[model samples]
Target chain A: MKCRKLKDSLSAYISEELSERQMSRMSRHLATCSACAGELASFKRLYERIDAVPQVLPSDDFEERFWRKVKDADAGSSSVKALPLFDWTLGFKWGVSVAVAVVVMVGAYFYLHTSYGDKARGKSEIAEMADIDRYLEFYKNYEVIKKMDFLIKLEKDKSLGDNNLPENRTL
Target chain B: MRYDRDTQLMLAFKRGDKKSFDILFKRYSVLLINYIYRFLGSRHKAEELAQEVLLKIYLAKDTYRPKAKFSTWVYRIATNACLNELRRHEYHHHSVSLDASGEENPVNRKVWMDDQAFTPEQSMEKRGFEEAFKEALKTLPERQKAAFLLNRFQNASYSEVAGALSCSVASVKSLIHRATVGLKDKLKDYII
Candidate 1:
């Protein structure tokens, strides 16, 4: 491999990502090359130095303070949720309105069904009217003659009505 | 079982389990805070950013896909949080090195296989070297610094680095290389 290629491959080498074959070729190049070898060594040393740098602990109460800030931020966001409860009330009002509508429908059904219902009304009315007409016709045909006979008898009696007239009666 | 436990834990959090969320926060907070601290060189900012990352996990638990390792996913979130926080503060505009010299820096105590192996003079010399070395680390570009720290300190792969930075693997490689080259140049005088 060329020096440029080996230089670029140093990162992958440190990371152990290069395949065995590629590693071998790069090793061979490094063996023969002075500048690349020095460069690789320095890179390795730098990696080691960075690793050797002591890990620092966070300050006392750092985590606690951090969580406090997070809580504040979260609380800030949740406060935004407060305004939408008004919209929730609107939704509840809609639910109450629907319930009222259902109650009104149920009340109307019973009121209209029993008080003004058309149950057996037509048959009874027709039967009563037919009976009245039949009675009238019967009276016109037979009873009228019988009544006329009685009226004639009464008229004959009326000829003697002057004799049958009570006192203080006008004939 | 581990993956199941984690996924179950996340699902529980999704169902409004604050205890599950607290468990997750406590579980990954140190590593994530360390990752951010290394990136931005500020423990205070790192801790703050770590909390933000946890909060995001809390909010985004519903959409989290468990196809990859949970650590990978959380690291992705942590790194992004650190980056966003750093950007908001514009910390990159002025480089801040976290290292310090001598006994004044609490973290600078030397590791000793044997305490008698080093004299006070030798320890002082080493401390000076370490301080200068840290000074050199500040010379790298901000992206390079982030790439280097995430790759070396976190053992992040190029693909993972790319994932964290929203860049391609090739670009991640270039960033690492440039970072290494910059460090190498700064430390060339002391290399054996």
Candidate 2:
């Protein structure tokens, strides 16, 4: 085996997971190639460092806690088997939230876009109220101007006998 | 015994022998804790998740099957639990230093003991190397990390790792190789 071929097998070789024939080939290559041997040493040291990591033990009450959970599981319902099976519950929750949001949005759309929400109608109503206020103000200022300008013009036209009114004209 | 020691025990429990289940628990609870602790890098999380696995095994008493080794089955459940958790949450690697003699951490507090105790400088260097190893492990993809840890550290044979990971032996080999190379790249400074 060339250095390149055996380079990739270094990890597997150290792990002894390689085929016996492959392991023999790599062992021969390592004996011949000083570079591969040093790389092999590096991989070995790395493994040693990893193996040297101290063991992490559980708490003193680990057994007590585990037995308690077992008892609880026996007494209560069995949900562990159902854990991965209920992925639909998450989808269902999202569906509900989206539905509620859509309903609110549609309601707001109607509220803001319907006939009752017309800005034109609101403006017209405001104008009508303003016209009534104007008239009331003028009537308050007038002494007895019960005869308005249009009414005076009509009366004068009748007194003068002017029956030939302009076409499409209205009195 | 239909299966290995654990499977026999599981089958015994299946036939109304609760004491067998107790034996299984004693044998695996700490081992599972240690395995998950390395996988998750959190002792508390490992302890909690190991109990969850135990609960899963206990629940399997009634409907247990001896398809594989009992340890393989338990590790399958554990690996799934760990992977599911990793999917749900981002794992932050918390590596403890050896120099913190005042640390209340159990892993850091108890270390290698010898007649010639480690000097403070040597302790610091060891701490750096340990943290670097953890960081390197943190960089591996979840499946690759699972395969490597199972084979190199957890004493699972290649076929056992395959069973636990639900993959083939070829894939386990490839994953372990990639993980080893990744570690080499990350720990190049300490490789000498």
Candidate 3:
């Protein structure tokens, strides 16, 4: 192997990642090459310098805190699982239910308000007609009446057809 | 005994054994926390993320099938956790400063470097070289840092690195190559 090739493989050689044949070739080259040998030595020292950085340990409370978290998580999960199925409902579900309720209420309100107003107006018209008929019958019992002084709506107006009647027109 | 103990402890943890989790935490949290701290360069964030990593392990215990060695699995988790923390820190435009207070300044307290730096000129050269080396490392991409740390510091083989990093062995070689070239250029003054 040339020095360049050896240099390329030096880290691999140190890491034992090179193939056996490549390792053998690099070893042979290093034996005869002063420059490559020097290069390898320098690399070795640099590696050692980096390795000499002391590994820092965690704080004394690290393990205790870790276990405490674990226990809390465990307890939380177990408590969740132990609760009744109806004990929990997600926010989205609740929002959907509220939305559905508002829609139904609005629909019902419009339906009832329009229908109730039409029914009440029809009942009041019928009551006014009944009162007029009662007055007409009561006045006929006397057989005589003043035309202007005792004015009465004594009969239904038959000029309008049922389909085109003004009483049924809403607007 | 260590492997056996770790395996048993993991198995027990998988079975919802709290004591086993405590043992695993005791065994690995310090190393993992240190690994994250060095990678992220912040004690506060490192501690928080390290706790998160351990918590993830606890949550994932049931899913761990032991297809790989336990140590390898845990180290892979630690490595990924640190990388994520580093990326997050970088995204926020933060630089890591190793706060050396009082007796903690390793360079000033170094006996070997002191002996070699007999003159002011030599001391300047040494300081200049070390600074350049650190700058080069700082400029390295995340993948290169991961490859360098796993390959050199953790003594992981290419295949193991590939497994840990979820990359091909060939990719591992390329990453290490790039990292070594960068480092060599950085430390050229000191080395050559």
Best by TM-score: 2
Q: Root-mean-square deviation of each candidate, in angstroms?
A: 17.3, 13.6, 13.8
Q: For this target, which candidate reaches the highest lDDT against the unseen true structure?
A: 2
Model 3: pairs clashing at backbone N, Cα or C within 3 Å: none
lDDT of 3 by residue, A17-129 (tens): 88999989989988999998887887787777667766667777876777788889999888867764544654557779999999999877765676565464566577668
Instruction: Please give the distance, in angstroms, between residue B26's alpha carbon in candidate 2 and its true position after superposition.
Output: 2.0
How does candidate 1 fare on TM-score?
0.58
Q: Provide the fnat value for model 1, as a fraction from 0 to 1.
A: 0.49
Model 1 Cα lDDT, one tens digit per residue, A1-171 = 479878988977877767899889889988999998987888887667666767666677866876777788778767767666656666788889999999999877755565333232345566668989999999787866866765665678788764453455322
Residues B1-192 of candidate 3: C-alpha lDDT, one tens digit per residue? 345567778889888787998788777776666656655556776677889888987898878777666666776787777655554544324322212112223332212112222332443465664444444555555556666777775667788777776677777777787688767656665565
TM-scores for all candidates: the values are 0.58, 0.63, 0.60
Candidates ranked, most accurate by TM-score first? 2, 3, 1
Worst 10 residues of 1 chain B by lDDT: B95-104
| lDDT tens digits, residue span B78-112, model 2 | 88887666645634233332112222344322121
Candidate 3: residue B37 lDDT (0-100): 60
Which one wins by lDDT: 2 or 3?
2
Q: Model 1, residue A101: displacement in angstroms?
A: 20
| Off by more than 4 A, model 1 | A70-83, A86-171, B1-12, B15-23, B66-69, B90-135, B189-191
Estimate every model's Cα lDDT from 0 to 1.
0.67, 0.75, 0.66
